[model samples]
Every structure is written in C-alpha cells, then in structure tokens.
Target: MRIAIVGGGISGLVAAYRLRTRLGADADIVVLDRAERLGGILYTGDVGGEPLDLGAEAFVGRRPEVPALLGELGLTDQLVTPAGRRPLVWAGGAAHPLPPRTLMGIPSDAETMRGLVDDDTLDRIAAEPDRALTWYPDGDQDVYSLVADRFGAQVAERSVDPLLGGVYAGSSRSIGVRAALPGLAAALDAGAPSLTHAVAAALPPPSDAPVFGGIRDGYRVLLDALADAAAARFVTATPATRLARASRGWVLDPLGLVDAVVLATPAPVTARLLRYVAPKAADAAAGIELSSSVVVALSLPQDTALPDNSGILVATGESLRAKAFTLSSRKWPHLAERETALVRASFGKFGDEAALSWSDADLIAAATEDLATVTGAVIDPVEAIVQRWPGGLAQYAVGHVDRIAEIESATAELDGIELAGAYLHGVGVPACVASGETAARRIAESLSAPAKS
Candidate 1:
C-alpha cells in the first residue's frame, strides 16, 4: 500500500513510524512536510555551546505512551525527570509558591492558598460547600466561567488562567473544560457537589514519580530516533496542497496516488486540504481557533543566582508582560551542568497578540524586564534566541468535543483518510503520540479489511 503522511510534526512522524512497523516491508510510505525539516515545533537550538529545547521541553511522566515508546526505541536510559518540581506564580507584585494538592490550579485546600489570595477571596472559597450546586448545562462551557462561577473571579484569574495559559497559550475564559481538562469536566458532569470536592475526587493520589520528564540530550534525540526507525521516504519542503478521490484510493496534489493519507498538520492547513472532499469536516476544522506565541530563551552568566524553583507562572492581571518564566538550568539539571544559566520566558496568549507583534529585540527586552521583576535578580543574557510560533496553539473552545465528533463522522464517510494531531485530543506529546498511533492502526485496519465487493 502507498501511504502519505502530511505535516511531519511529531504526530505525522510517529504515524509514519507506526505505519512502517505495522505494514512492514511491503508498505510504501512517504512523510511530507512543508518545512525543510521534520519535528515541527519540537526544535532544539545550541546556546552557549549547549543544546536547549526552544519548543516543548518535556512530557508528562504519568502518561505511559511516551515512556513506552522510548523503551521500544532504546531511549529508556535517556529519560530524565526534573530536578525541582515546585513552580511559583507571580502575582500581586510578588512571586508565591503554587499551592500544593491542586488540580490544574484549583486548590484542594483553600487555606493553602492564603498567600496567593486575599482573606475575602479565601473566605469565599472556604464557603464553596455552602454555595448552591449549579450543574453545567448540556454541551460545553469555558473553563474560566466554570471556575469563576464556582470559586470567585479572583481564583479563576489568579490560578486557573496562568496554568491554562501556560499549557495552551489560551485564556481560561476561552478554552473548553471538556476538551482542556477532561478529568475535571467528567467529575463535574457526574454531578459532584462542589468544584473543590469534584477536583479532589478526580485527582489521583500523589506519587513519588516526577510529574514531567525530559530527554537527557534534548527532544531532538527522540525525533532523530523516530526518523531512523521509520526509514520512510521523506519529502521535505512539500505540503499536500489538495486531496482528490482517485479511481483507486486518493491523490495528494503533486504527490500522485496513495492508498491512504494521514493529515497530521495544524487545523487550518488540514481544513484547507479537506475543503473539496469533506467540506463539513473542513468547516469544523476551520472553526478551531489558534493562538500565536513567542518564546525568548536567554543564556545568562554562570554567576547569576537563579531561584531554586523550576519556574514562575505569571497570573492574569499581574504587572508583567511575560506569561511565564522557566529556569531551564534549574529545571533540567543536565543543562545546569553547563557553565551558563539558561532561562526561557514565554510571551503572548490566545487573545493577546501585542507581544507577538513586537520585534525580537523588543520582545527579549520585555521578557528580561519581567524576569528581573519575578526573580529579583539582574540578568545580563550573553546569548539569546527568539522563536515566534504563529498560531502555535489551538484553542479548544466550547462545544469543541462535539465539533470534533462531527468532523470525525464526516471524514469517516471518505475512505483511506484519517486526521491526527495535537488539535484532536490533548496537546501534550503523549496525547499527540497516541493520536498518531491510533490513526495508523485505523488506517491499517481499513486497508486490511475486505473491500465492498
């Protein structure tokens, strides 16, 4: 079978890799990417003679998918957990440690958040049990609204926004609960008495395993491993412009006929390709909004006394332009072994594009200023790299799950085609990997099944 996997991001690459494994030597598989390189946003750059991840740095350790994949690829020894786990939040002109035992910024114990919130807000949160139970209506609701309605606007702004923004580069008011925090959503849907109670009930017991893990060298190693294992034909700087139903299977523009195609591209790109064959699916894909963001990585002098904390998340309404700052050196000890202190500052969120509009110099300056305020240490970055990801994050808005369902239904009518990416399911590396593997297996099954004779 001739198969073409589009996008060449982690999802596409993983899909291609899995397809090769499932179909073995008989499969004619080609991976196509618009860029000259694969790995998409999983980019690593050299800073001060050390490799640093400019894009995603780590994956959640709780998800077995990535770890299992690493084992299979002989990369089990490369996994390294963070040296420090506690991350602070910059709010009220100061940095405060994030409260413990919280489910995605929702504190399990109100008293633990005393330093983060005022007494009045704490009192309101303490009274969560007394508040009237209001079940979410059918369909979807924004995370901010749900949290704010249950636990005051201050909690939503200070806690929920920062955590969600850090993950999706999206606002809590815009991201859907069902899509973004499925566990919390499920607990709520089950009619849990209160937000606190629901979160506590939904959260698993704390474990000794680190929440996140990264590669010892860099994510680049993982990408390189996948590429070597897949051994598929790679077509760089070429994107699947169009998809047409051919007499045999499908024809990808300029790529000729393929028995199957997997779209691992971003939503907008996928939507355009599917417009002709599956218009409804394309429309649904188009509805998925994206957010642009910028990451400024700075290599400070070795003498810089960075905080022991892994990073600092800037709460909404904080007097800082940078959304969050990661003490890369401290978080990843491997980087700390180098003679320089590495830090990464994130700017821009779903609705905020002002930072992205700034020049690289301006953005770096702004990030430096914010970092100084949060860390209380003067920073003189000897080397700096600014990466601008336009439409880097997909905003899973209300009714997103339903819309995805509809998209899948429409696309299912068309044979030998599948959609897979961070846009579908969660945006984490594990989620994307699972999505890719699932797509590959589905395609394999479809091809192996007896045709409608």
Candidate 2:
C-alpha cells in the first residue's frame, strides 16, 4: 500500500516517521512538501552562524508527550535547558522574579505573589476568590476575561495578556484561553477550589516539569534526524493540487497517487485543497481564522546589558509594537559569544500585522522603541534578520471544540482521508506531533476496516 502525507511541517514529519516505524517495509510511503525544506515552520536559520531557534524555542517540560517523543526520536542526549537563573516576568514597570508558586501569573495562593503587588491590591483580589469568569468554554470567553476573572483584571491586563500575546501574537482578551490553556479551564470547573488548586491538579506533577529544552543545534536537530530516517519517496517543491478518488484507493493529481493522505498544512490551504472532495472537512478548515506574525532576530553588541540572565516577557500592555522580547543569548548562552547577544524581537497578531509591510528601516525603528520600553537598552543592534510568516498561525475561538467535532464527524464518512495539523488540537510542536500520529492511525484503521467488512 502507498501512503502520502501532505505539508512538510513537524506534524507531517512525525506522521511520516511514525508510519514508517510502525509499518516497517510493509508500506510504501511518500511525503510531499511544496517547499524545498522538510521542517516547515521549524526552520532553524543561522545554523552555523550561532545556534538559536527562530521558531519553537523550548519544549515545555509539563508535556509528557514531548519527553516521550524525544526518546522515541532518540534525542535523549540533545535535551538543552536555560543555563541561567529562574526566568523573570516583566510587568508593571520592572522585572519581577517569578513568585514561589504561580501558574502563568495566576498564583495558586494570593500570598505567594504578595511581593509583586502592594497589600492594597492584594486586598481587592482577596475579596473576589470565585474569580468567576463571565466567559466559559463556549466560544464566549477569551484569554484576558478568563484570567482576569480567576486572578483579577490587573493581572490579566497587566501580566497575562503579554505572556499570551507572546504566544499567540494576539490580544489576550480576544484569544480563546480555553483553547490555549485548557487546563486552566479544567481548573475553573473544579468547584470551590482556588484556580491555583485546580491548575495543579489538571496538569502533571510540577516536579516532572522540564525548565525548557531543545536540541543543542536547535530544533533542526530533530528535523534532520527525522529526515535521515525517512526511506520513503520524498517529493519537494510539488503541491498536490487536487486529490481525486481512484478505484484503487486515491489519486493525487500531478502529485502522483496514494492509498492514504496526511494533511499537516495550514487550515486555509487544507480547506482549498479539499473543498471539492471533502466539503465538510474543507468547511471546517475554512472556519479557522488565520493570524500572521514576524520574528526579528537582532544580533546585539556584547556591551549591551540585557534585562536579566533569564529571558524577559513583555506584558501585553508594556509593548505596543514588540509583543515580547527574549534575550536569546541570555536564555541560551551558547547561542552567542562573550561579546555578542542574540536578542529576538517579535511582532504580529490580528490588528497589528502592519509591521510586516514596513520597510526594514521602519521595522527596526519600531522594534527599537519596544526594546527601550522593555529594557533600558540604548544601543542599536549591529545586525538584524527579519522573518515574516504570512497567514501561518491558527486562531481558536470559543465553540472551537464543538466546531472541530462537527468537522470530524463530517470527515469520518470518507474511507481514506485524514486531517492533521494545529487546527485540531494544541498548536505546539509536541502537540502537533501527536495530531499527525493520530491522523496516520485513523487512516490505517480506515484502510483496514474494509477488509473486515
């Protein structure tokens, strides 16, 4: 049997790798990528120049799936973590050391972060323990609303938004926190308990958390490792424009034929490709709103005194242009020399993609303004590399889960079609890996069912 996987992102690669590993030489698999690259958004630029991840910086230790995947991929020795002190949360006016016990600024106990705010502010928070979010999982609540309710408006607007903004390149109030941090939602559902207790229970044990980790050469190490293992036919720079069903199984127009297909591309692209063949899948794909973003990697002169040894996160309010700033060199010292700093400035989201069209000069100017606000830095970066990702990221809203359920139901009627990408589940690297593997399993099951019949 022949299996074809579409889109070359990490998800697709994982699907390909897992399928190969599982089926052995039984299945003839081929991965089709329109780009010459294999890692999709996982691209690691300046590989030899100075190792740093332009895409996913570190894998969250909280995710057991990540560690499991690492071992499965034989990347056990490549795990790398921050080399410095605990990370600092930049909020209000200064960088505050992360309190003893906090979950994304929502302290399990109000007293834990007492040093962060005055006693008066803490009093206001204590009066409201329910933190009952007017918003719920029903596409009605947003990141800011949920956090502000469970924590307080001050924490949400001042601190939480920026951290979330850094992740989604979006406004926290509008973002679907239930989608991004479902554990928080689960915590909220726990009755009478503080959001803190709920959070602790919903997530794996805290001790199991990895500070943060990636390959020494960056994420590319995994991508390179996967590519080396793929003995299947590889097709690059070729888009499977149309997927027409053939009696044998399926025919991918101009891109050759296949028995099964794994789509790991963006929603819009996937929607357009499947519109004619799988209208419901296409419609489900179309419902997903897209977001654009740009990451600016500025190489600073060594003399620059960064905010701290640990990286910095700009409260959404703190940065008008640059949503977040990370002192990459500080976060991963090996990425720079004694005299150089690999500082990353990020910009993007629904209303703020204008930064994408700006001339290189304008972008640098705007980013510089953010640099000044977040850090007291006055020196100009000696070199800058700007990367713009147009319509790449997926946005999940309330009712998103339900909508996906409907889409899945509609697509299930088909025998051999499979969908995989960030659109369905969590949008992180490890999560995407899980999605792709799930898709492959679905396809494998569907292909076998006919024989049983």
Candidate 1 lDDT, 1-453, residue by residue in tens: 899999888898899899989999889999999999999888888888778888889998899988898899999998888996589988888888988887788877688788998988898888987887787647678988888887778788888888988889988898988888788888888888888888898788978988998988788888899988888999999877889999989999879999999999999999999999999999999999998889999999988878898999999997789999999888887888988899999998988878888998998899888888888899889988999888888888988999899889999978789999999998889999998999999999989989976
| lDDT score, candidate 2, position 245 | 75
Stretches of model 1 off by over 4 angstroms after superposition:
none
Cα-based lDDT at residue 351, candidate 2: 64
Worst 10 residues of 1 by lDDT: 131-140
lDDT of each: 0.88, 0.72
Error of 1 at 398 (Å): 1.1
The clash count of every prediction, one per candidate, is 0, 5
Clashing residue pairs found in predicted model 1: none
Which stretches in model 2 have alpha-carbon errors above 4 Å? Answer: 72-74, 89-94, 98-100, 112-121, 130-140, 149-151, 193-205, 336-339, 448-453
lDDT of 2 by residue, 147-253 (tens): 56656676675556656666566666656756777777766655525555565666555473445666777788888777667667788998878887787678876
